[model samples]
Target: MNIAPRYLGRGSWLARRDPRVLIVGLALFVFSVIQVWDLRILVGLALVAAVYYRSARIPFHSVRLQWAYIVFFVSFIVLANTILTGGDLRDVKSQALHVYFRMPLLNTPLSAESTSYAMAQYLRFLSMAAVGFPIAFAVAPGDIGPAFARLGVPDKFAYALDLTFRFIPSLAADMRATIDAQRIRGYEWEKKGRGPIGKLTRTVPLLVPVTVNAIVGAEDTIDAMDLRAFGTGRRSWLRELAMDRTDRLVLAGFGLLLLAVTAASLTGLTRLWVPPFLLPA
Candidate 1:
């Protein structure tokens, strides 16, 4: 609900860097995190993620909203995998909050080892998500649009990216308004039922009016841009980005950190898929 335009977000480190480097560096960080999952490697990644959000001027509250779904999704997968694990059923049970379960038609005892493996995989995913999301968060759509086009991203694709940035905030804002309107009409999200369907039932109604309003807003935006001859020619950027010395320094440091992670991971200095310490029987 705390939606605002992409480029208009508060200042941060990545935002201040030239869009070209921001784009390229983001790609590098993502690739590295996906391929490498050493705790040591992720130690640096965590720093990069933190620095990116800090530099981009993104508010902590805004960053939290942007990342809540990812955290929730990863946590959910971990829980499911933990319960269904064939080897260890209780690997992460203590850490996990109770989420209602749906009974399968077939009866089978999940193994602890399988569950442990699944939990490890889930943890790996979470590590990567924790590292990569902030970079994604810092990437402003306006910068991405032109930067991609310059890098040979098709104009159509670039436009799609641009539109994605434009839509996120506008849509979020619209939904917030919808919720407020519904609240006035005696709707309360907390009062909704507990099941997954309950969530869908409660949320789906808010979207109907929000979606319509979004469409109307989009039409108005298009009309306004058309009046201003928005795409009649070259796309000029509102944020003037030029790579500076600080950008070079930060990038070089991250590059070294990435190399260290790769080395540590391959050499067995950091292990990501290892289960947490368990008490001996």
Candidate 2:
């Protein structure tokens, strides 16, 4: 089942740039987001990511599934943090009634501080995904190994990373094929009859076939690579990834941005900031 459409297109400037540059810039961007525990700073980074996504021509719909995953994850984080981090409930009494319900059933306390903390963490994850998804879609598989190699990553590890990106779509397709094949035989795993345990029991059969097939495919791939003398010595990728003028500009910009953000964080200017709207006078 090919669940995702290709978000990368030929016309986008991001698609034309070097993957190594994207990887390095994205690392710095994530580092900036991590240094400051502030929603405003994270939102600023998200806005920057939005502009990059637009310039790359990656439509939101293309990555809607990824967004769904992020939403689910963020929900979990919000719930977990709200419950686990204890604070006085009186701090949030002035907010609307819905804000009161943000707490869980674990006899957990809620306060403006806790709410801000949870939100800051949630936005941190969201901002990371916002930047990450674009890079994942924009970079080509063939360039992945070379990109990592240029980063001083070991050749074997770089090749492994390249294969991982190349095979993810194929693995998804294989899973879909297996499920369809099973369904055609009057076997319906999603028919909604089973409880959790029963559902797990029903799913095991599906996993067995998929696992076996994947193992076989992996063995074949390994054999092919061995025959080609892969990883035996100095390895060259099929395509050479060179840092061009555009790549240099992007890298330099990211370096400056990283330095400025780090300086602000170290000076405590962007630490523990909660928007005024979230605070009660």
Candidate 3:
């Protein structure tokens, strides 16, 4: 019953099918999700990632594990930002609306446009999160590192990124072990009392072990890199990754998207944003 999904399908172990395509696909996915405050683009990007996730064969369950967390986090952010803030970048006194805003007159009336922009921006965050759900699950850290490295990302930064990816599984395993150890010692986290202080007591010990383990893992990684002569010179990729027609197509699609976003931002297209009818008119 080992139905676990791997990162790459129908490709070499290192995903050598097409580094260019993977690089562009990943970049497009990230850049597009972040660049806009529009729901249409956000939904479009999420659908695109869903397709990519299926193609990549990354486990859907792995991603769904955090669905509740994502929902809670995004919902909280959107609600807080929208309700507490106001104003758009186009406003004469344009203030960057965030969760908390500083006002010269705390009692001054908030503008409708500011409130709308705040809500829109928060929706923007939710949209990006929705889009990124798959990437968090489907893209294996090991599989994408070399492709990113070859795509002109600085070698040191690439290595750091690779190592950062590697930490996920390590952190997960460490958390499980720590939780089990705590449970065996008669500490019941869920059954713990309410309030922030009780929550802190329950989580503090769990985090300490995870942190210590992370440090130990980092040390091991440093030692291994030193043995391999890391940073001594330009190191060759373990395997030669190439570009396929599909990869080219996807990347080109992103180039087109980049152009579109550039045009929209430059031509004041985004200035036409309007809040949905459910919002204040």
Per-candidate local distance difference test: 0.60, 0.76, 0.59
lDDT of 3 by residue, 177-236 (tens): 888999999877887558878888788889888898788768878898999899999866
The digit string of per-residue lDDT tens for model 2 on 1-281 reads 35533646456888888888778888988888888776777778778877766667777666677789889989997876666654433224434322433435665645556677777887788777766765677876677788998899999999998888778888888888888898888878877866888988888768999888888889989999999998788998778878888889988987887898899988877666657776566
Model 1 lDDT-worst window of ten:
94-103
Clashes of 2: 1
TM-score to native of every candidate shown: 0.60, 0.84, 0.66
TM-score of 1: 0.60
lDDT, candidate 2, equals: 0.76
Best by lDDT: 2
Model 3 residue 109 CA deviation (Å) reads: 10
| Model 2 ranges off by over 4 Å | 1-7, 88-109
For model 1, state the Cα shift of residue 195 in Å. 7.2
Sorted on TM-score, best first, the list reads 2, 3, 1
Worst 10 residues of 3 by lDDT: 1-10
Query: Residue 96 lDDT in model 1?
Result: 40
